[model samples]
Target: MITVELTRFRVSPGLSEALLAARSAMLRDFRADRDGFLDARLVRLADDEWLDIVSWRSSADLAASRAKGGNRPGIRAFFELIGEIVSSEEGTAVEEAV
Candidate 1:
Protein backbone atom coordinates (compact mmCIF):
# COMPACT_ATOMS: atom_id res chain seq x y z
CA MET A 1 0.00 0.00 0.00
CA ILE A 2 1.06 3.54 -0.63
CA THR A 3 2.31 5.45 2.40
CA VAL A 4 1.64 9.11 2.72
CA GLU A 5 4.17 11.13 4.70
CA LEU A 6 2.98 14.52 5.78
CA THR A 7 5.20 17.20 7.29
CA ARG A 8 4.40 20.74 8.35
CA PHE A 9 7.00 23.40 8.99
CA ARG A 10 7.64 27.11 9.11
CA VAL A 11 10.33 29.15 7.39
CA SER A 12 12.03 32.25 8.66
CA PRO A 13 11.12 35.65 7.29
CA GLY A 14 12.48 36.70 3.86
CA LEU A 15 13.73 33.24 3.00
CA SER A 16 11.06 32.22 0.51
CA GLU A 17 13.40 32.15 -2.48
CA ALA A 18 16.04 30.15 -0.70
CA LEU A 19 13.37 27.80 0.64
CA LEU A 20 11.92 27.15 -2.80
CA ALA A 21 15.31 26.55 -4.30
CA ALA A 22 16.26 24.21 -1.52
CA ARG A 23 13.01 22.30 -1.93
CA SER A 24 13.63 21.95 -5.64
CA ALA A 25 17.11 20.62 -4.97
CA MET A 26 15.75 18.15 -2.47
CA LEU A 27 13.11 16.93 -4.90
CA ARG A 28 15.73 16.25 -7.51
CA ASP A 29 17.88 14.40 -5.02
CA PHE A 30 14.91 12.35 -3.80
CA ARG A 31 14.01 11.38 -7.35
CA ALA A 32 17.56 10.31 -8.05
CA ASP A 33 18.39 8.62 -4.76
CA ARG A 34 15.24 7.42 -3.11
CA ASP A 35 13.45 4.31 -4.28
CA GLY A 36 9.65 3.97 -4.48
CA PHE A 37 9.16 7.68 -4.51
CA LEU A 38 5.89 8.24 -6.28
CA ASP A 39 5.33 11.98 -5.93
CA ALA A 40 5.25 14.93 -3.58
CA ARG A 41 3.61 18.28 -3.09
CA LEU A 42 4.59 21.45 -1.23
CA VAL A 43 1.71 23.52 0.01
CA ARG A 44 1.68 26.91 1.64
CA LEU A 45 -0.64 27.10 4.62
CA ALA A 46 0.13 30.66 5.66
CA ASP A 47 2.75 33.36 5.31
CA ASP A 48 5.55 31.28 6.82
CA GLU A 49 3.95 27.89 7.36
CA TRP A 50 4.03 25.10 4.79
CA LEU A 51 3.05 21.50 4.39
CA ASP A 52 4.82 18.71 2.55
CA ILE A 53 2.81 15.74 1.37
CA VAL A 54 4.94 12.98 -0.06
CA SER A 55 3.74 9.62 -1.33
CA TRP A 56 5.85 6.51 -1.38
CA ARG A 57 5.16 3.12 -2.90
CA SER A 58 5.18 1.38 0.48
CA SER A 59 5.96 1.82 4.12
CA ALA A 60 9.34 0.18 3.77
CA ASP A 61 10.26 2.58 1.01
CA LEU A 62 9.28 5.52 3.15
CA ALA A 63 11.30 4.17 6.04
CA ALA A 64 14.31 3.63 3.85
CA SER A 65 14.07 7.15 2.50
CA ARG A 66 13.76 8.66 5.92
CA ALA A 67 16.88 6.86 7.05
CA LYS A 68 18.93 8.52 4.35
CA GLY A 69 17.24 11.92 4.12
CA GLY A 70 19.37 13.64 6.70
CA ASN A 71 22.56 12.49 5.06
CA ARG A 72 21.81 13.99 1.71
CA PRO A 73 23.09 17.50 1.04
CA GLY A 74 19.94 18.68 -0.69
CA ILE A 75 17.67 17.35 2.02
CA ARG A 76 19.89 18.91 4.67
CA ALA A 77 19.77 22.21 2.84
CA PHE A 78 15.99 22.01 2.70
CA PHE A 79 15.74 21.43 6.41
CA GLU A 80 18.13 24.26 7.12
CA LEU A 81 15.69 26.63 5.51
CA ILE A 82 12.97 25.59 7.90
CA GLY A 83 12.79 27.54 11.12
CA GLU A 84 10.83 24.82 12.84
CA ILE A 85 8.97 21.64 12.07
CA VAL A 86 5.45 21.83 13.41
CA SER A 87 4.43 18.22 12.82
CA SER A 88 5.13 15.03 10.98
CA GLU A 89 3.07 11.91 10.36
CA GLU A 90 2.87 8.93 8.07
CA GLY A 91 0.26 6.31 7.32
CA THR A 92 -1.14 4.02 4.69
CA ALA A 93 -3.00 6.04 2.15
CA VAL A 94 -6.72 5.47 1.82
CA GLU A 95 -7.80 4.21 -1.56
CA GLU A 96 -9.76 6.63 -3.66
CA ALA A 97 -11.85 6.38 -6.83
CA VAL A 98 -9.77 7.06 -9.88
Candidate 2:
Protein backbone atom coordinates (compact mmCIF):
# COMPACT_ATOMS: atom_id res chain seq x y z
CA MET A 1 0.00 0.00 0.00
CA ILE A 2 1.08 3.54 -0.55
CA THR A 3 2.41 5.28 2.52
CA VAL A 4 1.94 8.91 3.37
CA GLU A 5 3.97 10.65 6.01
CA LEU A 6 2.89 13.88 7.59
CA THR A 7 5.06 16.07 9.73
CA ARG A 8 3.85 19.27 11.29
CA PHE A 9 6.10 21.70 13.07
CA ARG A 10 6.65 25.32 13.99
CA VAL A 11 9.35 27.35 12.36
CA SER A 12 11.69 29.79 14.00
CA PRO A 13 10.79 33.48 13.94
CA GLY A 14 12.08 34.43 10.48
CA LEU A 15 13.60 31.34 8.94
CA SER A 16 10.80 30.32 6.61
CA GLU A 17 12.64 31.15 3.44
CA ALA A 18 15.81 29.42 4.48
CA LEU A 19 13.93 26.37 5.67
CA LEU A 20 12.01 26.19 2.41
CA ALA A 21 15.13 26.51 0.34
CA ALA A 22 16.79 23.74 2.27
CA ARG A 23 13.74 21.52 1.93
CA SER A 24 13.65 22.10 -1.81
CA ALA A 25 17.30 21.31 -2.16
CA MET A 26 17.03 18.26 0.01
CA LEU A 27 14.13 16.85 -2.01
CA ARG A 28 15.87 17.57 -5.27
CA ASP A 29 18.99 15.79 -4.19
CA PHE A 30 17.40 12.93 -2.32
CA ARG A 31 14.24 11.86 -4.12
CA ALA A 32 15.98 10.86 -7.31
CA ASP A 33 17.95 8.23 -5.46
CA ARG A 34 15.19 6.99 -3.23
CA ASP A 35 13.39 3.85 -4.36
CA GLY A 36 9.82 4.58 -3.31
CA PHE A 37 9.81 8.31 -2.96
CA LEU A 38 6.90 9.63 -4.95
CA ASP A 39 6.60 13.31 -4.06
CA ALA A 40 6.47 15.80 -1.20
CA ARG A 41 4.64 18.97 -0.33
CA LEU A 42 5.52 21.76 2.06
CA VAL A 43 2.70 23.87 3.35
CA ARG A 44 2.61 26.96 5.51
CA LEU A 45 -0.38 26.79 7.81
CA ALA A 46 0.21 29.92 9.89
CA ASP A 47 2.95 32.40 10.64
CA ASP A 48 4.83 29.85 12.67
CA GLU A 49 3.26 26.56 11.64
CA TRP A 50 4.27 24.41 8.69
CA LEU A 51 3.49 20.97 7.36
CA ASP A 52 5.48 18.50 5.34
CA ILE A 53 3.73 15.70 3.54
CA VAL A 54 5.59 12.94 1.74
CA SER A 55 4.35 10.01 -0.28
CA TRP A 56 6.03 6.70 -0.90
CA ARG A 57 5.19 3.68 -2.97
CA SER A 58 4.96 1.50 0.11
CA SER A 59 5.49 1.43 3.82
CA ALA A 60 8.53 -0.80 3.47
CA ASP A 61 10.10 1.71 1.16
CA LEU A 62 9.49 4.51 3.61
CA ALA A 63 10.95 2.48 6.44
CA ALA A 64 14.04 1.58 4.49
CA SER A 65 14.69 5.17 3.51
CA ARG A 66 14.12 6.40 7.04
CA ALA A 67 16.39 3.73 8.47
CA LYS A 68 19.16 5.28 6.48
CA GLY A 69 18.41 8.58 8.20
CA GLY A 70 16.76 10.20 5.12
CA ASN A 71 19.78 12.43 4.91
CA ARG A 72 21.11 13.90 1.75
CA PRO A 73 23.59 16.72 1.27
CA GLY A 74 21.23 19.41 2.50
CA ILE A 75 18.94 17.45 4.80
CA ARG A 76 20.82 18.22 7.97
CA ALA A 77 20.64 21.93 7.33
CA PHE A 78 16.94 21.63 6.49
CA PHE A 79 16.22 19.93 9.80
CA GLU A 80 18.23 22.50 11.72
CA LEU A 81 16.03 25.37 10.54
CA ILE A 82 12.86 23.83 11.95
CA GLY A 83 11.58 23.89 15.51
CA GLU A 84 10.14 21.02 17.51
CA ILE A 85 7.70 18.81 15.71
CA VAL A 86 4.17 19.43 16.88
CA SER A 87 2.83 16.23 15.36
CA SER A 88 3.70 13.44 12.98
CA GLU A 89 1.78 10.57 11.47
CA GLU A 90 2.17 7.87 8.87
CA GLY A 91 -0.26 5.41 7.34
CA THR A 92 -1.41 3.66 4.24
CA ALA A 93 -3.20 5.79 1.70
CA VAL A 94 -6.87 5.15 1.13
CA GLU A 95 -7.40 4.25 -2.49
CA GLU A 96 -10.00 6.16 -4.40
CA ALA A 97 -10.59 7.03 -8.01
CA VAL A 98 -9.88 10.58 -8.96
Candidate 3:
Protein backbone atom coordinates (compact mmCIF):
# COMPACT_ATOMS: atom_id res chain seq x y z
CA MET A 1 0.00 0.00 0.00
CA ILE A 2 1.16 3.56 -0.76
CA THR A 3 -0.01 6.97 0.30
CA VAL A 4 0.09 10.23 -1.67
CA GLU A 5 -0.02 13.57 0.05
CA LEU A 6 -1.21 16.39 -2.21
CA THR A 7 -1.25 19.94 -0.97
CA ARG A 8 -2.44 23.17 -2.57
CA PHE A 9 -2.31 26.84 -1.64
CA ARG A 10 -4.70 29.53 -2.72
CA VAL A 11 -3.96 33.20 -3.08
CA SER A 12 -5.71 36.37 -4.13
CA PRO A 13 -8.60 35.71 -1.74
CA GLY A 14 -11.98 33.94 -2.18
CA LEU A 15 -10.33 31.06 -3.99
CA SER A 16 -10.49 28.64 -1.10
CA GLU A 17 -14.20 27.93 -1.57
CA ALA A 18 -13.78 27.28 -5.25
CA LEU A 19 -10.78 25.04 -4.62
CA LEU A 20 -12.59 23.10 -1.89
CA ALA A 21 -15.69 22.66 -4.02
CA ALA A 22 -13.50 21.19 -6.67
CA ARG A 23 -11.93 18.90 -4.12
CA SER A 24 -15.33 17.62 -3.08
CA ALA A 25 -16.27 16.84 -6.64
CA MET A 26 -13.03 15.01 -7.14
CA LEU A 27 -13.52 12.98 -3.98
CA ARG A 28 -16.85 11.81 -5.28
CA ASP A 29 -15.20 10.60 -8.43
CA PHE A 30 -12.64 8.65 -6.42
CA ARG A 31 -15.35 7.05 -4.35
CA ALA A 32 -17.14 5.91 -7.47
CA ASP A 33 -14.00 4.26 -8.80
CA ARG A 34 -12.82 1.40 -6.68
CA ASP A 35 -10.09 -0.23 -8.70
CA GLY A 36 -7.48 2.51 -8.77
CA PHE A 37 -7.82 3.82 -5.23
CA LEU A 38 -7.83 2.51 -1.71
CA ASP A 39 -8.92 5.66 0.13
CA ALA A 40 -8.50 9.45 0.14
CA ARG A 41 -8.89 12.35 2.53
CA LEU A 42 -9.22 16.07 1.89
CA VAL A 43 -7.88 18.35 4.58
CA ARG A 44 -7.88 22.07 5.07
CA LEU A 45 -4.87 23.85 6.56
CA ALA A 46 -5.10 27.54 7.27
CA ASP A 47 -7.24 29.80 5.13
CA ASP A 48 -5.67 29.13 1.77
CA GLU A 49 -3.85 25.86 2.09
CA TRP A 50 -5.18 22.30 1.76
CA LEU A 51 -3.84 18.77 1.79
CA ASP A 52 -5.09 15.55 0.25
CA ILE A 53 -3.84 12.27 1.57
CA VAL A 54 -4.52 9.41 -0.85
CA SER A 55 -3.87 5.75 -0.35
CA TRP A 56 -3.17 3.53 -3.34
CA ARG A 57 -2.47 -0.11 -3.86
CA SER A 58 0.64 0.64 -5.88
CA SER A 59 2.51 3.30 -7.81
CA ALA A 60 1.42 1.63 -11.00
CA ASP A 61 -2.19 2.32 -10.07
CA LEU A 62 -1.40 5.96 -9.53
CA ALA A 63 0.44 6.23 -12.84
CA ALA A 64 -2.25 4.40 -14.70
CA SER A 65 -4.91 6.70 -13.28
CA ARG A 66 -3.01 9.80 -14.34
CA ALA A 67 -2.29 8.28 -17.72
CA LYS A 68 -5.96 7.48 -18.14
CA GLY A 69 -6.97 10.82 -16.68
CA GLY A 70 -8.33 9.52 -13.44
CA ASN A 71 -7.34 12.50 -11.32
CA ARG A 72 -9.89 15.18 -10.33
CA PRO A 73 -10.97 18.36 -12.06
CA GLY A 74 -10.56 20.38 -8.87
CA ILE A 75 -7.10 18.89 -8.50
CA ARG A 76 -6.12 20.11 -11.93
CA ALA A 77 -7.67 23.47 -11.24
CA PHE A 78 -5.80 23.62 -7.95
CA PHE A 79 -2.50 23.14 -9.77
CA GLU A 80 -3.46 25.82 -12.22
CA LEU A 81 -4.24 28.05 -9.28
CA ILE A 82 -0.84 27.20 -7.80
CA GLY A 83 0.80 28.84 -10.77
CA GLU A 84 -0.90 31.94 -9.47
CA ILE A 85 0.17 31.30 -5.84
CA VAL A 86 3.02 29.77 -3.84
CA SER A 87 2.73 25.99 -3.55
CA SER A 88 4.92 22.99 -2.87
CA GLU A 89 4.63 19.19 -2.87
CA GLU A 90 6.46 16.46 -0.98
CA GLY A 91 6.13 12.66 -1.01
CA THR A 92 6.89 10.82 2.21
CA ALA A 93 7.52 7.25 3.20
CA VAL A 94 4.97 6.35 5.86
CA GLU A 95 5.75 3.71 8.43
CA GLU A 96 2.69 2.11 10.02
CA ALA A 97 4.75 0.26 12.59
CA VAL A 98 3.27 0.52 16.06
Candidate 4:
Protein backbone atom coordinates (compact mmCIF):
# COMPACT_ATOMS: atom_id res chain seq x y z
CA MET A 1 0.00 0.00 0.00
CA ILE A 2 1.05 3.54 -0.62
CA THR A 3 2.20 5.50 2.41
CA VAL A 4 1.20 9.10 2.93
CA GLU A 5 3.37 11.32 5.09
CA LEU A 6 2.16 14.61 6.48
CA THR A 7 4.42 17.05 8.27
CA ARG A 8 3.34 20.40 9.62
CA PHE A 9 5.91 23.03 10.46
CA ARG A 10 6.61 26.70 10.69
CA VAL A 11 9.35 28.69 9.05
CA SER A 12 10.77 31.93 10.36
CA PRO A 13 8.83 34.98 9.24
CA GLY A 14 10.02 36.44 5.89
CA LEU A 15 11.78 33.23 4.80
CA SER A 16 9.08 31.57 2.75
CA GLU A 17 10.94 31.96 -0.51
CA ALA A 18 14.13 30.44 0.80
CA LEU A 19 12.20 27.67 2.47
CA LEU A 20 10.46 26.78 -0.80
CA ALA A 21 13.72 26.81 -2.73
CA ALA A 22 15.29 24.50 -0.22
CA ARG A 23 12.28 22.21 -0.33
CA SER A 24 12.44 22.05 -4.13
CA ALA A 25 16.09 21.13 -4.02
CA MET A 26 15.54 18.56 -1.36
CA LEU A 27 12.73 16.97 -3.36
CA ARG A 28 14.85 16.83 -6.46
CA ASP A 29 17.51 15.00 -4.51
CA PHE A 30 14.98 12.59 -3.05
CA ARG A 31 13.56 11.72 -6.45
CA ALA A 32 17.03 11.13 -7.76
CA ASP A 33 18.44 9.10 -4.89
CA ARG A 34 15.66 7.67 -2.80
CA ASP A 35 14.21 4.29 -3.64
CA GLY A 36 10.46 4.82 -3.38
CA PHE A 37 9.67 8.51 -3.64
CA LEU A 38 6.31 8.85 -5.37
CA ASP A 39 5.80 12.58 -5.07
CA ALA A 40 5.58 15.57 -2.71
CA ARG A 41 3.64 18.75 -2.21
CA LEU A 42 3.94 21.87 -0.07
CA VAL A 43 0.96 23.78 1.23
CA ARG A 44 0.60 26.93 3.28
CA LEU A 45 -1.72 26.63 6.26
CA ALA A 46 -1.16 30.16 7.51
CA ASP A 47 1.56 32.75 7.70
CA ASP A 48 4.75 30.94 8.68
CA GLU A 49 2.97 27.65 8.93
CA TRP A 50 3.23 25.04 6.20
CA LEU A 51 2.58 21.42 5.45
CA ASP A 52 4.70 18.87 3.63
CA ILE A 53 2.88 15.92 2.16
CA VAL A 54 4.95 13.18 0.69
CA SER A 55 4.02 9.86 -0.82
CA TRP A 56 5.98 6.63 -1.02
CA ARG A 57 5.39 3.17 -2.36
CA SER A 58 5.05 1.63 1.08
CA SER A 59 5.31 2.32 4.80
CA ALA A 60 8.72 0.69 4.87
CA ASP A 61 9.91 3.20 2.28
CA LEU A 62 8.78 6.08 4.46
CA ALA A 63 10.51 4.63 7.50
CA ALA A 64 13.72 4.09 5.60
CA SER A 65 13.75 7.64 4.28
CA ARG A 66 13.15 9.08 7.73
CA ALA A 67 15.92 6.94 9.16
CA LYS A 68 18.31 8.34 6.54
CA GLY A 69 17.55 11.95 7.25
CA GLY A 70 19.36 15.03 5.93
CA ASN A 71 22.29 13.13 4.50
CA ARG A 72 22.77 15.48 1.55
CA PRO A 73 23.28 19.21 1.20
CA GLY A 74 19.81 19.93 -0.15
CA ILE A 75 18.09 17.90 2.56
CA ARG A 76 20.26 19.48 5.22
CA ALA A 77 19.46 22.94 3.92
CA PHE A 78 15.74 22.19 4.05
CA PHE A 79 16.01 20.97 7.65
CA GLU A 80 17.91 24.08 8.72
CA LEU A 81 15.13 26.37 7.48
CA ILE A 82 12.41 24.96 9.70
CA GLY A 83 11.70 27.04 12.81
CA GLU A 84 9.49 24.43 14.41
CA ILE A 85 7.89 21.12 13.55
CA VAL A 86 4.33 20.85 14.81
CA SER A 87 3.72 17.25 13.85
CA SER A 88 4.50 14.37 11.52
CA GLU A 89 2.58 11.23 10.80
CA GLU A 90 2.30 8.52 8.17
CA GLY A 91 -0.37 6.03 7.26
CA THR A 92 -1.69 4.00 4.38
CA ALA A 93 -3.16 6.06 1.57
CA VAL A 94 -6.85 5.36 1.08
CA GLU A 95 -6.99 7.04 -2.30
CA GLU A 96 -4.82 8.92 -4.75
CA ALA A 97 -5.45 10.90 -7.91
CA VAL A 98 -3.12 12.27 -10.59
Top candidate by lDDT: 4
Pick by TM-score: 2 or 3, better one = 2
Where in model 4 is the C-alpha error above 4 Å?
none
Model 2 score (lDDT): 0.83
lDDT of 2 by residue, 1-98 (tens): 78999999998898998987788777876676678998888889986899988899998888887776646667667878878899988988889339
Is candidate 3 or 4 superior in lDDT?
A: 4
lDDT of 3 at 29: 67
Q: Against the hidden reference, what TM-scores do the models get?
A: 0.89, 0.86, 0.58, 0.94
At residue 79, candidate 3 shows an lDDT of: 44
Model 1: per-residue Cα lDDT over 1-98, one tens digit each: 88999999999989878989888789888998999999999998887999999999998999999888667799889888999999999988889439
Model 1's alpha-carbon lDDT is: 0.89
TM-score, structure 3 vs. true? 0.58
Better of 1 and 4 by TM-score: 4
Each model's lDDT comes to: 0.89, 0.83, 0.58, 0.90
Give the alpha carbon lDDT tens digit for every residue of 49-77 in model 3: 66666766776666665564535664456
Clashing residue pairs for model 2: none
Q: Rank the candidates by TM-score, best first.
A: 4, 1, 2, 3
